[model samples]
Target: MRAQRGLILLLLLLAVFCSTAVSLKCYHCLDPVVSSCNMNSTCSPTQDTCLYAVSGMQVYQQCWKRSDCHTEVIMNLLEVAKVKFRCCQFNLCNKSEGSLGKTALLGTTVLVAILNLCFLSHL
Candidate 1:
């Protein structure tokens, strides 16, 4: 009986963990300066990279894939080399709040609390 209960609890935790682990995220900004701080948001799965680009005085932060990154755009007649990009795979690896990771943790914590309350009520 105890083992069965443990298994159920394990399953619950697993469900929580699985529910929120796969989303991609990155920072977004336009016309930002050095003091500018961008916020991260969920990105499409096809976006395999986080891009930070600077042209003249403008800044753009975006989520992108290598293919997208390679097929570069020459904005403002700037040379392709003048535009820069940085890509990463980890969640919120850019200069934004890593909310996806935090959200997953919060979801698991809430699930644990709800389960605890349910068990206690049964007692």
Candidate 2:
């Protein structure tokens, strides 16, 4: 029974480590221009844009007037050097928040794993 518990704990720790490892953001992937605007500002393609060192990493976005007064914008995660463009759009405010939650969860899992590993080793 003790051995089984140890194995389960080890597996959990491994999972946590993997989650945290992948959660690290790639700085090169950051959108430089668009990142500067105030979160609540009325942004447009002209006002909100991102430039990246990687040739095609720029993202263009804008928030227009609507019934809900919400933001609407298109994102293009592109690699001009590789000739690739990943495009997406968001009108909902919770989009980025959800990703942030995932990152936090992964980080927490990793922290738990490390703590568990340390505790088990001591035992």
The candidate that wins on TM-score is 1
Model 2 ranges off by over 4 Å: 1-95
Tens digit per residue, CA lDDT, model 2, 29-58: 235455443333323433222221223544
In model 1, where do residues sit more than 4 Å from their true spots? 1-21, 71-81, 96-123
Best by lDDT: 1
Q: Please state the error at residue 90 of candidate 1 in Å.
A: 1.5
Kindly list the per-residue Cα lDDT of model 1 for residues 1-123, writing each as its tens digit: 766676677778677555534566767766546545557777776766666666656666677665665525534333545665455554555553334457557757986897786576445
